[model samples]
Target: MTDCDFLVVGHGLAGATLAYVLRQRGYRVLVFDPGQADSASNVAAGLINPVAGKRFALTWNANELLPAAASFYRELEQCFGQQFFFEAPIFKIFGSLDEQSALLTRSPDHPWGDYVASLATTDPGLPGVQAPLGGAWLRHGGHVLVRELLAALAAQGEREGWLWRETFDWTKLVTDPTGARYAGRVQARHVICCEGAAATQNPYFNWLPLTPNQGEVLDVECAGLSSAQVLNRGAYVVPVGGGRFRVGATYRWPPFADGPTETARQELSGRLAAITEQPFAVVGQRAGVRPAVRDRKPLLGPHPTVPSLSFGGGYGSKGVLLAPRLAGLLADWLEGKAELWPEVDLRRYAALYRPAAGS
Candidate 1:
């Protein structure tokens, strides 16, 4: 058995980022991943949009989260010596004059307007594309190659003797006043559950509201297409070099399953047609289940009754943009450097966990 400072379960964006943060803070960390369920971060394109939607509104907490995510990922890339994060601008293609008019109606001096990188009254003349109404370039918008990121993060952890490739068992977990013992193989000061959707089944964190949302994306090869900016209207077409683009993703509530559906592929292809007249060949399609909360806030902080247990999950689609910042916050809280944000605190939903009406 080996002792450590922190044991993180689930190597998805949530777990991996938290492990990286804790490791950076000089904490002895061990990470475990059970490939028993779908991970939303695996197939995530990692697109970070500042100004989004038809109204060209800023993404939630863009002003603060954007810069933090930017610097955080940049430093990670340099530290890991991998080409994982791509800094690119997203172009919001206008479908109609009303869309453009409504966007212009908002004062540029507004706080949200700071994220609008730029806009053009006329089309930017992207080849094989039909943006007759032009589009706007959003700043602080980019993507992290999630698959590469997780792999690189795990490799780094392994190099530091902080990563394990095995399934963590709940029955073997025993928590005392000081720390936790896992199957007598690993001992840790705290056991944080970053198990994504599987957190819904965790005995310690199961009470928290976690909704599984399924999303799908298609990888395609198109010749003679510009490999510059990300284009978005109803769907997004992101160039991944070599004239290939990863276009996706269909967001469905009450997800039927965590697998690619024919319906989603057809829907994505249909939407991709709006980006350009150029025909493309579909190479592959993938899907994963994202962990979302009822209030759309992150699920973080230590277990209410177990000080040696902690949790960080429910990042949903914004995992790339939210994970770094949230991990820092959680790490700080764990080290007694800060308090957990009320919006994301697990205690907020304790009422549901408590026995009801004098049971």
Candidate 2:
């Protein structure tokens, strides 16, 4: 008999949530993670915005994903007796009158209108903010305390003897139709890789187009800023309590590198400046590579030939808002309770998989 029903690799948002869902479904799970400080989930601001981007369009599947995310995190909160999800309004400061008019015109009739809490034609009266063109207060938006949630899950997993603090070694993994064995000591009926950006290097599934991108964020102390709401202009300033805010994310593609860069710090600082005139001091900076997919959709499902091996990652910047719901869907698929949605199913890319030499 296998030691566990599923062995999950990586304890970031994707793996942690998947493991929890599986366990709730009565499956024994073992999560392996070395707790990499630079993992994308750890560095993410955990911002949950239903509307985003230059067009300010509703996020894909926002209607379903947002509610699922809230319920999942709330259940975890009740289970752990610790709060991780924070619901607050996001103030989207418009850069120009055209932008303001566009949202004002569409918000009244568009489906995205449901998420618009209010709109202002004049400055929203936010201190230290530059919003001459006014803005929109988007409801159902907030940030998650990601690290805290991960820690709580890990603590519980550790206490239950299901969490292993070690890096997953590909060479030590053996898989077949029946199951997978790790280092000849742990046997699991199935193995799922949730390795974030690192999955691009996964020998079995790297053939899929996993475009990892580097992103950076800065932690700053802005004394006058309101801690009750998120301010979004070109860059987002998320209040993290005690007058400290997480300001981020500069996106860089290709030629990815590790560690924070001075260029990114300056870019973030500049964006923060554009958002607010309040004096602030940069206290910290973090950098991580986001596991983005070619089509900007999450990758999920088992290897074509190796049924025992599976993958669940590439949620990109939307991991926090998307992981929980997708985790449930993945668990459902695993138990043969339902089929994966066609778009996210790995079978969509089956033609791209070419067996490695000597495989």
Candidate 3:
């Protein structure tokens, strides 16, 4: 009945990446995804920024995650015969003297301080942009074409008979002492639920404290901007294709009504307008709920109750940079080789769950 060694739910970056890694390891993998509307990974700008504003701190695990991510995506490109990942510096514009001072103030103690260099006293070629106090330059940080990568992975999965295109039937799902089962049917040695925000619905893990963030982005045509470096001000204006750019994104927590709304669009548009003086046209507007957690860390590893079933999500805005590395760790843990990240391991939240009444 269509047996598979691994069955991964959700075809977003997390799911696709997990499946690809297992397949590379020579395991029989099957993916279940319905191509649902507006999964967070689909709407992500795929920016891998090292230094973030609002404290100018290095992203969590930026040093290790960045190199691992670069090597992983480059290898995937070679295997899939495609070019979607590009290495470009990110230019975070300083809006005022205070923000610039804040940046220089924290440079010494910051982990990513090495990548943080003051604007060279010479012309850097960036034009038509406001640089009040100039800004920091990050070397290893760059962008990945998320949509293209997803499309490639899906295509590759289809060709290899590793992908099953359909909504995951929870009723058909079963777990026991041996391992996880799909459709009350096909037995797999491992089953990972990379279902993004949908993890909040899983009875076994619902109480783990998932904070879904509703975010939106505006796709605009910003013609004549040649430099592909990600432009960041109040909001990030990331170039996508055909002189078009994806600008975003506003965050709303708990009580966050899912899906795109007019309110979000106006807020995002206003933020973009405030940052750039160049004429821009809004071509599209989209939104999705990111599966963020309270500690701002991703949730990975096995289910607290169901040992066989695992989860990999809650990456929030850093899904592009975080998922690949975490997916590899999941693979390692499943294969019994490596220890899971304590910050992401599900056991960290075990105190919240009551262990299903009794053992």
Candidate 4:
């Protein structure tokens, strides 16, 4: 049985990024992934929008996380010998004068205001496709080629003897006083679960408040679309490299078992058409569950009772923006070098459920 210092489950952005971070720290790591479950990271357009939506509120913790993510991805590029991050400005088009007024109104108090450039009074190059009442540019925001990055990391991990492509069977797991064992076989110093929404299935953390939401995105061919800038009107049109754009993200609370449905497709298409006059062909449709929490904060840190098990998830739609920082934070915490964020530390929640110390 192969033994390592660490074993991570799942290879989505969460797991993959964490594995990369741990490996960089000189930890002997083995990453296992089934590669079957629907992962939000795979289908994500990987947008990093500091300023977003009609309200245009800065994404939670954008100030602290954005720069950290940028630096992390750059270093990863150098390590992996590949580029997956692009610094692109988002074009937020105003559907009405009220929208423009809203942006101007909030620009001052909003922490992301300095990133927002002056509005363009005239419609730009994609006029045939979209009309602009005026739009602002968000600086220091861009997109990450999520799948490419994951694949690159996976490849690098493989070359470094750190990745295993297989489903993790919980039934085969065994634990003793010394350490935890997977399948009563491979032993590790610790096991960290990065299973995304699947973390809800783990018996230990299953009790954690998880409000998984289903989101869908349509990959369309936008041959003539100009610039890689993500277009924001009703739904976002994010460039996916190679002249393709991912337009979507329909949020369904209950979730559907059948995955993508005709109703959702029509709804997304209709929204895209409303935002742009251009005729685009739908080349692909993808759906996955966002591993969100009610408070919308990440869940990280070691297990409460299990000394050798750790967890890091709850990134939801912002996995691309949140994973790198959280990965570094997790690594630091594991190494006894840093403290976990109180907001994300699972111990904060455990205290409410589990009995108080010495009580």
Best by lDDT: 2
lDDT per residue as tens, model 2, 1-359: 34999999999999999999999989989999998877889899999999998998889998889999999999999998989999999999998889988888887686685788888989877877888888988999898999889989888888888998999998889988899898978999999999988987888888888998999999999898777789998888999999899998989997866689999999999999888888999999999999999999999998988989999999999999999999999999999999998889988999999988888
lDDT of each: 0.83, 0.91, 0.80, 0.81
lDDT of 2: 0.91
What does each candidate score in C-alpha RMSD?
A: 2.3, 1.3, 2.2, 2.8
Model 2: how far residue 286 lies from native, Å: 0.5
Candidate 1: what lDDT? 0.83
TM-score to native of every candidate shown: 0.94, 0.97, 0.93, 0.92
Give the clashing pairs for model 2.
Answer: none
Give the candidate order by descending TM-score: 2, 1, 3, 4
- Tell me the spans in candidate 1 whose CA falls farther than 4 Å from its real position: 35-38, 108-111, 355-359
- For model 4, the stretches where C-alpha displacement exceeds 4 angstroms are 120-126, 176-178, 351-359
Q: For residues 1-359, could you state the per-residue lDDT of candidate 1 as single tens digits?
A: 89899999999989988988898888888898854334689888888888766666678877778888888888877987877778887888888898877766764656575677677768899887778988787776888888887878777767767777788888799998899999878889899999898887777777889987889999999896666888898888888878899997778877365478889999999888988889899998988888989998898887777779988999988899999889999999999999988988878887877532432
Using lDDT as the measure, what is the rank order of every candidate, best first?
A: 2, 1, 4, 3
- 2 versus 3: better lDDT goes to: 2
Best by TM-score: 2
**Candidate 4 lDDT (Cα, 0 to 1):** 0.81
Worst 10 residues of 1 by lDDT: 350-359
At residue 292, give the lDDT of candidate 1. 89
